[model samples]
Target: MKKFNITVNGNQYEVEVEEIKDSSTSAPRIQHQAPVAAPQPSAPTAPKVEAKKPVVTNGAGSVKAPMPGTINDIKVTEGQAVKAGEVLVILEAMKMENEIMSPADGIVKQIAVAKGASVSSGDVLVVVQ
Candidate 1:
């Protein structure tokens, strides 16, 4: 018979085993010692992640997502006239709500993203012209 002590996840356990010479022989006996205290786990921490900013391409009057997230709401529609800094879309990222505003005064030429659509950084949300 052999005995061994093991520690896993800050918990201690004792195990015992009996040797068997052949597969045709009887199975080995196993025993366990009294259980030790419950394991103590440290608090988990959130990972540090950098926010990504939207990239402006050659497309004129394009409004892009500043970060990866889901489109929460669209405040404007196609062909709607908008002024610079007016909220055109609402983006939800990292549990926070962000307003995507128009970059210039123009009519909305296109809406690339819809409500509940997932968009990555630099993805076009709307186009005004």
Candidate 2:
């Protein structure tokens, strides 16, 4: 009989083995010690992540444009408190009315275009502080 020790994952285990021989038989008999169960692996976990929207801040503030067509309605006045994505003005572009929303939550600092006026792309229609 022979005894041996094995270590795995910082754990140690002891085992025994035996050998037997018969005079009439050519083959030798072998015996193995009881097997020790291996430790089970833990399941992997998913990482936690957060989703956020993009925001930009400048010295002046946020600026949104009036649509392509004529100004049909102006809903907000200057120095008014407005929330982010608030509709400030409406423009009649391509025979359809479009609402120009505020980019950020702030006070309306300036109004660049007047009611019933025309505007083009990249034009600053209003400023939000």
Backbone clashes per model, in order? 0, 0
TM per candidate = 0.55, 0.51
Q: Could you give candidate 1's per-residue lDDT for residues 9-72 as a string of tens digits?
A: 7678877777767779665565658966665669866889875333343468888888899999
lDDT of 1: 0.82
**Candidate 2 root-mean-square deviation in Å:** 19.4
Predicted structure 2, TM vs. truth: 0.51
The lDDT values for all models are: 0.82, 0.72
Model 2 per-residue lDDT tens digits across residues 6-114: 7767465667665556556555555544556666559866778754232333346655453467888988999899987677888888888877777778899889889
| Angstrom error at residue 33, model 2 | 84
Clashes of 1: 0
Clash pairs for candidate 1: none
User: Compared to the true structure, candidate 1 yields what TM-score?
Assistant: 0.55
Best candidate per TM-score, number?
1
RMSD, every candidate, angstroms: 9.9, 19.4
